[model samples]
Target: MNNELTFVSWNVNGLRACVTKGFLDHFHSYDADFFCLQEIKLQEGQIELDLGPEYKLFWNYAQKKGYSGTAIFTKHEPISVHYGIEDNEEPEGRIITLEYESFFLITVYTPNSKRDLSRLDYRLEWEQRFASYVTELKSKKAVIICGDLNVAHLDIDVKNAKSNIGNSGFTAEERACMSALQKQGFVDSFRHLYPELEDRFTWWSFMAKVRERNIGWRIDYFLVSEQLQNHIIEATIEDHVMGSDHCPVTLKLAIDVS
Candidate 1:
């Protein structure tokens, strides 16, 4: 069996809408071992996807219709699958945890701070809870965390950084939360692999055709436990694959998923 495995995470904006925009084309082209998604904006029986039996599909839906949601399609069936962090009950369907032999895979669509920063306080609380939850998981086994973390950790993560300072995604508090997580025991896979690469972004605004100009933010990410750092081979952003406002971010690891 191949020792290396590729994983892909994308915030499809809305899976149903994205499918009309060529989601399946990109999904088949990548053929990753695990394909995780967020902002799926779906509920039960909303749509049917036939990815074939080789893959196991899991979905977490928000109680509200067409709102925050997530899903994971994996070729390997995990020992167990969990929705939400223990006892936290994230009813928005924002987190999915899968347990495998050597590691745990978690996909999260973190709550976004509203444009006016009205939700900033709630977002901060979530950041702490999520970081602590992942840390706890890391204590048991290596953890791979991915999806729209919704923060730009460094100035390099967003275009026109100077102008965007203190904005929702680039706020000092939000950035610090991400930094603290890395300082603990997790590594941002993309940044760790290409420390100085520039003009690399994941999410772009639909406003003003800015995506054509490559003006965007690298808010989506794949983070790995410190112990799994060396297992990373390629951490990449599929910026050209356009089916949503945010593109796919991939992590190629030298470790097996099962």
Candidate 2:
């Protein structure tokens, strides 16, 4: 039997809005074993998605209405599910973790620093806490983390790298945080496979039709523990299939959770 497992991660922007724009069509086409989503932008009871009975759904809703949120639909039931990082209260509902017998899967929507860099300090602090949380979990089992990390770790990740250096996603501080995380025994699946590839982005600006020009950033990612590096089968950016500003990123692994 094929032990390969397919995992799809997308920042839908708004799940309700994306659904009207053929989200369901693309969702079915992917047919992934695990479909993780970020920035769902809805509260509980606001939207009910019929992803079919084959997939079990888990959601982490924000305290604020129509704000940050995350969800995961998996074919295999998890041993346990966790919301947020550790015991801290996550008002924005940015994280969801599923624990299996072999591995732990986490999907997170990392906070954006904003255009004016007003929230940069808070975002940096959150990064440290997030790294700590995942590192602690890594001690127990292998980890697969996928999400819209809201930062372009390297110049190769952004189209206008020089001009956007001080910007929210490309700031030195944010890039350093990503580098630190990777140093802590994590490998960026896509970069590990194709380090020289460029102009391939997961997010784009809706204004000025920049996506047509391919002016975008690779903010979404799938990061696995260093131990799972050898099991990496494929990492792809589904840039053509999109209903939101961000497209889906997929990771194929040789190991099967079931």
Candidate 3:
């Protein structure tokens, strides 16, 4: 059996819409061991996916209709499944955690600060709670966190970092939160693997053909515990895969789930 495991994360924007745009084609092609998704923008019973018999699906749907949500499709059965953050009510249904023998895999669709930064305060508060929850989990076992984090963590993470400074996703406060998370023994898998790679991004604007110009932001990420750093084999941005505003980001690790 293959010892390596493959994982894929994407912000589908809207599951129903993405399906019509070839979501299944890309899904089948990747054949990832764990496929996590964010911004599903749908409630329970809203849609159904035929991902074959090998995958088990877990979803956390937002209370509000057609809004923020998350899901995980995994080939391996998890020891436990959790939704939201430790019993605190998450009306947005932004997080889902699957516990395996060696690690806890969490997929989160972080709240955006919005264009006017009106939600910036709330977003920061949410960040604190999220960080604390993950830190607690890390104390027990290694963790693999993946999804659209909503913030570009570094200057190199955005196409026009200087020009975008102070913008919602590129603000100093949001960036600091991401830095703090990394300081707590987590490694951004892609950046760790390709520190100097540029012009590579995951999310792009629909305006003025920004995506075609490669003017995008690396807000989606796969953050693994520092202990798993050496296990990372490959990390890539699947920019060519088209289904939503954000393309898929993939990670291949040398570790075995079995």
Pairs in clash, predicted candidate 3: none
Off by over 4 Å in 1: none
Greater lDDT among 2 and 3 belongs to: 2
Model 3 TM-score? 0.98
- Give the per-residue lDDT digits (tens) of candidate 1, residues 14-41: 9999999999889888898999999999
In model 3, the worst 10-residue window by lDDT is 1-10
For model 1 the TM-score comes to 0.98
lDDT of each: 0.93, 0.94, 0.94
Best by lDDT: 2
Q: Which lDDT tens digits does candidate 3 get at residues 1-258?
A: 338989999999999999999999999999999999999999888898999999999999998998999999999999999999968689999999999878899999999999999999999999999999999999999899999999999899999999999999999999999999999999999999999999989999999889989999999999999999999999999999999999999999888674
TM-score (all chains, Cα) for each model: 0.98, 0.98, 0.98
Once fitted onto the true fold, the runs of candidate 3 whose alpha carbons sit more than 4 angstroms away are none
- Where is model 2 poorest over a 10-residue stretch in terms of lDDT? 83-92
